[model samples]
Target: MLKLVQLYVYDLSNGLARQLSLQLTGKQIDGIWHTSVVVFGREIFYGQGISITHPGQSHHGNPLRMVDVGQTDIDEETFEEYLTEMRQHYTADKYHLLDFNCNSFTNDVVGFLTGGSIPDWIKDLPSDFLSTPFGAALRPTIDNMFRRPIPGAVSTPATIQPTPQSARAAINASPDPALASTLLQSVASQATLGPSSMAPPSQSTSTVAAPVHICTNPTSFHNTLKTHRAVVAFFTSATCGPCRMIEPLFDQLAHEKTEAAKLAGGIAFAKIDMGVGMGGMVGSEYGVRVTPTFIFFLDGIKKHEMKGANRAELTSQVNMLLFEAYPPHPHSKVTIPALEKVSTNPILFTQVPKLDIVTTKLCSFVDSASRPIPNSQTIKHTLSSEFAGYLRGQFSSNGKAVRSSATPQMLTKWTETTKTLVGHLPPSQLFPLVDMWRLAILDNVVSSWCATAAGNMTDPIQILIVKALSTLRSSEAPSTMRNYILTTLRLLSNTFSDLTLAHHVLSPSGKRSSVTSLVITTLLHEDASVRTAASSLAFNMAAAIQKVRIEQMRAMNGSVSGLDEDGEWEIELVSAVLEAIRNEVQNEDIVHRLTASLAFLLRLSPVYESQLAPLLEVLQAKETLQSKLEKGGCGEQGVQNNDIRSLIAQVAESLLVHMAWDNTRGGGIQHKTYRDCEQCTL
Candidate 1:
């Protein structure tokens, strides 16, 4: 008999998610979804891992929505066997609220029974929540909660295989708490992960072998070897008992080293089954005479071979290979407290001016223009009425609730209208319009809509910001239109609100050349306000870069080689910031922000002579920032310099104290190579 499968969806937040999701996360989330499969007269759910009870009678009560998910022909006995296999993966200790939860299990079950997936709105709760600034900030805190140990009998499940007692005892006995913490966190984090934390269970199975590459043919094996700097090939026969015994350990090692391999070029773990198609040929070519042979290949050359399935030797050899290929930085041994103290959050300019006043000022500027600018009356009305109403509904005031989010149709209309107005308005009069957009884009909904590419593959937000920046090209722009320039800089800073837009702006895809020019020019502007705005923009970009570096370093266990390959603007940004630091004798606020930007850029960068160190050396960064530490520099002549001076000194110390220039070579940092660094040795 084909049994009916229904999906029961519960709202973990009751109705509070709908009531306050927009206010908190800038998106309308109906609920924190919890789902289960109702089949065979039972409700099967995952939390403390796959539990069953009578229908509509789990700890979560009745579901808000019951989805009829077709029928399944598989009998209860076979289904139970499937559940038994699943128990190995979905143990109580492996359960995570966000990463691997009740919904993930049901999605997998639904896929198995019906060969169809659940609704995106149901499965996409984590991603949709994470898209907002508030949601992104809350993720680490949430993950940390699930990282704590489960209580009582909840800690153990029959199907779950415990980590080897030897490995656990070694890690616990280690004197270095940091090492133990790192190893423990890696295991804990991976336990709840089903492939990526974001992917659905059907798309991403719970397997430590997610990163491993299986090579069935010699062509495929050679391709894997060619691409990776390091390759570990497991030569195994289908009937070999030792190979079966050691297979799980190899998968675990692959999972552990996956992130490091990605950072340090590429490392691949390949399994070649001698009994499978063309696998015997591969083994013969590698001179593998034994069934359970393991070969380590570096740069396409066979480096070492081990005969037996010795787990300790295999683990030690792989670690040694990774260290040889991608060594840790020498600077990792040095302590830089100041750099560690720097926050990586992007600085945004979200100050909202009164919509009424801003609209009035815009109208006055257009109406009072010496010559009538194009689209003046139409844009004025659009700003004062249509856009004003939209902004009012989007932004909450005096604790009043924001209106329901704008629909796709409304957003499309606004996008078309804004694009038209931007094209028609004179470049000189574009700031007020751009300023309006600056406020609008602060609303995450509007920001997402604007960042999206239209049919022609052009982002409206990118175009609008670029147009505002182009006005700076005019010779008289700095003095004649300081408000326009400052407003544009502020808009650029706010672009960081949407990570997609911020990434494009920082990447080669974003008209980075124009932005670089704006930063270089505005940082030298005579007006302190203009310089301050530019400094904020610079800091936002630096924060984004620093954020990436920090994440990559963490993934690699604190051994990143350099900035991302796309960071072409690093040199220009460093030079421009250093030059600005030298010229700015007023505005301590600008000086402080600029120094922070410089510090973030320099910290944890490649210690090689060819990289940023040469530029910092040529520019004499230490001396330029050192001058600001003296009394009555970088601010008003009479102001007390204690606080600002102390801050500047810290930045200078963190950045410059370790830098040593080769005086004989004219202008380059003292060169350091990976091979000579003892700290990098495994």
Candidate 2:
């Protein structure tokens, strides 16, 4: 799969959400739309817009529409890591009124996830909102509110808020319990304990905050006050009417403690019931004889106190908890050299192969006297050129040609002409030329200009191969012509394993450039040899992808100074290869090639292990594939190439090994663990 994606479209103007927005703001909200990107239906990524709201709860309750947009091969953990690194970029403070708003966010996210932008109708809504008089005048209010969350809007009644986790949760979740407790203790004072325990910080404020636990009795109250970094208690009795009046506000403050913790001790809000059970003893120990009293505990000491129902005093006091817990953002305090480092390195491409024998065996050129050809002079000049003459073995039998005489410029010109020439020329004309162009990329034949060819955004081989594949797509095209085109593409693809080139070559823009789409189409081609050729192409693409993936990984390990240019195409490239293997075909040789290619990809990428559905299907449904293999047996011209069952077994083994390994962690292949599998070998 290229990218697996589901879209959540929350209509901000719908139902009570819209009514409340209007009722509170006294202006019609054109729309308060929010959307999130859900990957694999487990992890969610969406812009919350600028609001005091939890993700997906846009004051709108449930979303109006949730649609499946696309599919991806990136597993949840890797994708989530990317989102974590980019957390600050999507904050409410960075939200914009007209430009960088939620819709724009959906566009960026959807484009990255699916290679397809969100619909223009949705993206254009914010600008449309600004065109109106009311929207234009209310921009400042929206912008100001975006900079700071509105009070009392942090939690939604419709959404179930997750219970706050103590450091204990971290300790229990980790495998090394001893180290886990130690590490958990270290971050307990500062870090938000879980991905969902997110609110410890709001807007520009960065501080550590933990949940407030209600103390049931004096003993529990003592542990809470001593263990927690900050503590607050509302001393109330059955007779105090004012204490009862402010109880709900106290509860809300307890729930939303901001920047209120420093160490292993965390934030707690306890109530000492003055009239019952331990309530009387707790009140007496704290010297709280009054029916209602407030105590603030910081670091095991009484730091502040309040008496009576003073809501304003309580709010002001609670707000100061954050400044006490968090340090200012380091970026706001100091600049560092590490953050500004940039790299200077040259891009490298493979040394091209000397294709003399391979080129000669693949194609032969002769003066076709039968149907007098057009462009005979240009064709022969290209064919008989010094570089081509030696590369094609058309020179003297002494294995010599004037290759030294042709400059890189002349050879580059010949390659350029050859690419366009093959586009409209008969496929029969470009065999020797194809391999020669590939060789031109090698150090022996190429100059620095050849490297420029790739960097300058022109990949002759990719361009030529895509054009040939496109032309051969015609249903009426002769089987011989189709086979010839497929062979040329396979040969052209064999020479480059560079992902930088693959990025442009395999970009999923359209049929011509979308390498995966084209291969899938060709697998459906009638000619068995053409299908076989496409499978070979699949193998070559897999090899290229694996090599590039390993190299990129090593570069990242070494801290090599370069952006991971391959990340853009890694998903599409893998999808095209795996999906091509999964596409049904009659040729067993095709199946073998596809299986081998898939095995190669699975070996290189741990992420693809989760997407083993197609592979697993081939193994479990033996009866199903047996019929397919028999039907897809040898064509009239040849005997059965290879046993499809054997090929299926090969794919099954590749999957079983990884799935079993991954199973050790929990589950895989539809969440079925190795222990769960009756036959783990399969």
Candidate 3:
């Protein structure tokens, strides 16, 4: 069920007293100083304080007025967690009248939960007022005075209104009609969510993998030929030094062609390395045993061939053939490096205990009688000893080994149960469901499924999870739910990147899973938690890609350039992360994750060498610009004591170390993790 939102506005005083205060304070807006967001039916309120208080009981008494701010789909548990996280930044001890205050907190909470911020007039009022000369002059005293709440109000929700709204009318709908109309014209959207966020759960799911044809499968290859695209076969030998030498370039072309072929149908490359089994079959089929040979096929007909290491000739022929057979694509448009062949190793998922005892106990934790997810309440109604014993049976390890009770079917049912309760259940209750699923994946369920089911022609783990995600992604996900999803995606990608081989990552259907798409979307999500998780996932992906690429390069000797593609996902991942960080300047929480992501991404060279140095130069320029603005805006204190300035300095320092490492390579950063800057002691 969608929840209701209420914006509680408090006025400092009424009539001319309001005008007098603004006059003395030297601001256009009257003394509507404090705001609290009340989740009406839930009896929950969230506002800034030294800490969060439950039941919406605290603040400047009952608000003078409550404005309906539309509805939000966030469950109570989700909102509670959101409020909890908000308090970490806007804590009671940290509150400042001008900077971190009650009103600012409300706007953030309202914006995150509902997607629209509080009224623009109210949201901007404080910032605008503080920017004024008169308001600026008195800021220091106000900051000191309101650093902490008054002793009495800190503990108990104040029943008394701290200020009055009588003077509010004088300035609002006041004696002056013109001023009143302008100030009272509420600035808000029809709804904060975009049309897409409101889009109903889609019946459509892109579970089908993309296709690529292999050499042994002439049927698949024959079918691919129907597209009239050019296919290049690079026949190489294990003993041939030159074959290894040109292999990276050929592989690079293959990766680029794979992408290019998708949009414009230009070309595709298939590795026919005699050292690998498939290459021998192709070599024999073509009556060619020579290493370093390039065979081009267009419309199922062999059109051309290149022998020896005439690199220029091979490249030129393939280029011409591809252009003629398929539309040309400037894949060099985003030139980085190309990916190696997919690894044949199965991405074995790690496994763990089901811990049935804990899960069964949690079944009764929520007040089920109140029923959060309307259609689902059976688990809440029945606390049967029999069910508890059954759950316990799944976890019993007594002297003997406990037999596994967790299966794909069981997990699927559990997921369906949890998902149905998502909007209906509070976030606190919902997180456990996500955790349970994650553990199931960790306990080798994920790996087992990927091996047996994911690559299968039929639906199994991938389809089931994709359908579940479809349900999860269909609505305006509450912050907690989004947080859970982001965390899950991060975990999944991190594991997949680590354990899954390149071949295993590819589906038999000739396409890649939509997992990357999921991560990218969340990386750019409106929610900061999701973005943070996505950034962290990128870091893991880059590391995994680099590890595998390095391993492959090592096996190939010095033939391929030391650089294979810098992790398949890093280039795009870093680009997205950088864009988000650049856009969300006010969100201080994102900086740490962005800096961490950049640190890891910078570990990949050529790409890192190309990108990091210029980034340092840009960071230096930004620092200089900010230093100038702050000095110009509010004197030395503004320049010296600013949060953004401080954060900027830290980010620059972090990037500086990376640039230094980039220039020096790994010599300076050895044994130095991100936490202990290469220059700093561990």
Q: Which candidate ranks first by lDDT, i.e. highest? A: 1
Worst 10 residues of 1 by lDDT: 195-204
Tens digits of per-residue lDDT for model 1 on 598-661?
A: 8777766654335676666677887788888665565545224466566577666545543343
TM per candidate: 0.63, 0.36, 0.34
Estimate, for each residue in 1-682, the C-alpha lDDT of model 3 and write its tens digit: 8778888776534333265433232334555556667773433332323233343444344566777777888787866665554443333343444444555556556655566666766655655654433333333434333333343433211111221243232222112234432332211110011122222221211111112223322222343354445777777665899986886666555555454443233355655446432335557777776888888888778988788887778768866775555321111111121112222232322333354544554565445625554434554432223323333444455646444544444443453454454535544445444544444444333333333222222223343335336645666555545645654654454345324222233322211345555555666677766666665555455455455434433332211122223334445555565655555443444543454444444433334445544564655433532342343422443334344445445434544443333324556643322332433332
Q: What is the C-alpha lDDT of each candidate?
A: 0.66, 0.47, 0.45
RMSD in angstroms between candidate 3 and the native structure over all alpha carbons: 31.6
lDDT of 3 at 85: 45
Ordered list by lDDT, greatest first: 1, 2, 3
Best by TM-score: 1
